[model samples]
Target: MTKPKISIVIPTYNRADLIAESLESILGQTFDSWECIIIDDNSNDNTIEIVTPFLKDKRFKFTTKPLGYAKGANASRNYGLELSQGKYIYWLDSDDIIHPLTFELCINEFSWNIIDFCRFQRTVFFDNFDVKCFDNYNIDENVFFIDKSHIEKIINNELPINTCSVIWKKKSLGFEKFSNELLYAEEWEYYSRLVSNGLKGININKVLIYARKHSCSQTHEFNCNNYIRVEAKKEAALLIVKNLAAKKMLTYSLKRYFICLSIGFKEYNLFEQIISTIQISSVEKIKWQIFYTILPLRLSLYKIKKAIKM
Candidate 1:
């Protein structure tokens, strides 16, 4: 059997209705050297039926799991990693569709040097396909390209990469778990580890991925009953820092030290100065600045008012 060049992992829960569109986009790829590995994540709905027709293709196969009930993308991705035979790995959300050229373009820029992951920007698709670029429309003079070192800086502390926006090298994708044993921040949790390992990537600025905003998407579509997800995002960040510092894998500076404190507060941890020493020192990243400085103040005011009413 001929080994496939790329393994596209699509994890589905109950996205039976939308999986068809994503599969169609994959089928339409200009590059024909790829295979699609779809993980059902044990959906109770008709997602299996939606995908069954596609399995007729020789390159397409399916796997099912019970742990991925909500079937977060990470879980499906890990399952795919275990099952993939291709040298390159691409993850597509069951509900989102890609531009026909995405895989082709990504493969062209592919590098396995741990120093590069192929990257392109995404245009969020709302009710229609309205495009928004990072530089907006001014392509000639306004652009930002960072090397592996610079890219690693952003992932060092905050989530700079959107999981669905790029295909990752499976070798560099080591992480603790899919759901982080918490709510939000699953992507950040994995991304931080990848960054710390000195993984590299390419940024193609062109809009290749289309993020679908609809009624059931996890990040925003699902109803946010409480702030559990956001709180999880906050705590996972602290966990990332704690794990890094404890292992001596990171270093921090004074300002970053303070910023870590602020994130700790945001995570509902102690706001004391004692937490300040927990910082792992590093040089400044072009001197960080807070754009919306009033956010914390405004949040405090609202929380105080809510407290009084309660």
Candidate 2:
């Protein structure tokens, strides 16, 4: 009968082996005024069996992906956002673990200042949480006050804002939702779009989420040579470019970065898409053409050098 202070939305598929641990992490949270919503993307595994026990607690709600709806994590997350009944929303993966104090720290930050979202660092681990591999810590600064300029950092891959790290104010999101067309880089595009629209946020400089770096994870499977993943990256880049273009904030360096990604991923269509979105000088066009033509030579030379060393 009452809305919670925060809602944790997790989109999952066939994570039966790890879903319970993720749920238990939520159950162990120090903050109590929160609800957890799990949207299953039509998984064939016994994921439901693992989740059923947690439903008795009343704070955890589980639902299957609506039939005929776009089938992906993006769609599931959108549905979770629609069903959420909290002031703040946290997007988390089904296989990741949030620190016990995540909600308490984020809620405290929200209370002190009016921000669209609160962000924290995340640690990556493999096999188990004890064997940590990486962290998204900014060595030069402990706290980061983010604004529109940070969107460029995201586009440049200078910042790592994963789906699990940021807790967003629901109303501040307005009509924005995840792009269902994207299977990869959806979080990057969504967060970049929000930042481009002038969302204010703060980075708390604490690793509050533990991201699992197993081979089954999407990030691990995302390869530049993978056709579907490459297409998703192109779509995401185009969408972000259009958003920045509308705001008259599209920078030359940002455009170059997108072009490089497109070329590096072997998705030539993105080059044409970028040209159609905005006007490019003749010199820039020629430069891109030359770079595209020389790619084979560059690869050959690199391989030759490696073979010589071997």
Best model per lDDT: 2
lDDT of 2 by residue, 1-310 (tens): 4679999999999999998889998997889998999999989999999999999989999999889779899999999999999999999898898887889988988974668999888877777665132233333357767888787787786776889999999999999999999989998899988888888998888778888888776676674256677678778888888888888888878876776666765645777778778667888788877876686688799999999999
Q: In model 1, which runs have C-alpha deviations exceeding 4 angstroms? A: 66-71, 111-115, 128-148, 151-159, 174-182, 221-225, 243-267, 270-310
TM-score between candidate 2 and the true structure: 0.88
lDDT of 1 by residue, 98-205 (tens): 777787877876743533467667667775543232225332322344343553355554326666776776665655345525556666666555655566676676
After TM-score superposition, the amount by which residue 205's alpha carbon in candidate 1 deviates from its true location, in angstroms, is: 0.9
Candidate 2: list runs displaced more than 4 Å: 131-141, 287-310
Question: After superposition on all CA atoms, how large is the RMSD of candidate 1?
Answer: 7.1
Model 2, residue 302: C-alpha shift (Å): 10
